[model samples]
Target: MGKIVLSTNVTLDGVVQDPDGQEGFELGGWFHQFVGSGDLEAWTAAETEEAQGAEALLLGRRSYEWFASRTPSMADRVSSTWADSMNSLPKYVVSSTLDHPRWRNTTVLNGDAAKEISELKRKVDGQILVYGSYQLVRTLIDHNLADELRLVVFPVVLGTGLRLFGETCRRKPLRLVDTRRVGDGLVSHAYEFVSVNPV
Candidate 1:
């Protein structure tokens, strides 16, 4: 089965909202503001490398829309460059409302997220990466489906915003497999689920 990986950019307080400042949120651009110049370059390089290695990309509805709007010109660029790197690696967007994908090599998933992911894992080789989809990540976590987490933790805390994890969720112990300081002050960490108590 392919490894299911959750990768995200999060703040010190766990906020994962628009790090790029395009979302119209007052704090949407916190990443560029807080991340040190040196750290930013390292983080980008690391992320670019990770994206190049993904066999498939999984995204939530909101993330899909955001990506679609932000990089329309890069849609073909993505397909030709990184998108073409894998074995016809497709993108699966989980949504109840979206009826079709607007980009090539993209599919809309309307069924149970867990079941769909299980089927995909059975069919694919290498790793499937989930990026910047908090809601989907939460569901994957709840179902004990996520195999690994790659988090780039920034130094600044957005006093309020959407969080990567919620307080209501049960705690699951994670085994830290790797850690490194990238660019300026950003800390990159990789953790695997050690034990999961099914909800």
Candidate 2:
């Protein structure tokens, strides 16, 4: 079975809102503040490594639109190697409204989200990285579909914003499998979902 890995960048407070300040959120751009503060090269290398390791990408409708609109080629702002990996990877988007996706090697899952994703996990091989899909991540957690979480935590507290876990999220157990420091304060935590009913 393929592993569903949620890989996302968030603030120390778990805020996943606009990190690039493009969304006009009051507490936006927390991610950019770490540019010169820490070891940027190390962070970039870490991100690139993750992108290269991922076999495919899974995203929600909004995240797909956001990334498509911002970085069409997936190259401009990101490293060429990382961008290349991202552009070449097979992408699956869970959406009820999207009729056609412009991104290459893309598939739209418009049916029942949980069932489609579960089937996807069974079909696909290797790691399927889920990025910046808040609602989808919650659904995965709620349904016990997510197998692992790789969170790159930035050192900042955005007080209030769209957090990773909302009120709709249910209780789920996670076991910390790995932890790595990217830069000065950026810490990456990899947690494996602990199955309540083990098979």
> Against the true structure, whose TM-score is highest?
2
Scored against the true structure, residue 103 in model 1 reaches a CA lDDT of 60
Q: Report every candidate's CA lDDT.
A: 0.81, 0.86
Please report the TM-score between candidate 1 and the true structure. 0.87
Instruction: Write the residue-wise lDDT of candidate 2 on 9-44 in tens digits.
Output: 888888999988888998888788855545567777
Q: Runs in model 2 with CA error above 4 Å?
A: 72-76
Candidate 1, pairs of clashing residues: 38-183, 38-184, 39-183, 39-184
- Which ten-residue region of model 1 has the weakest summed lDDT? 78-87
Q: Where is model 2 poorest over a 10-residue stretch in terms of lDDT? A: 34-43
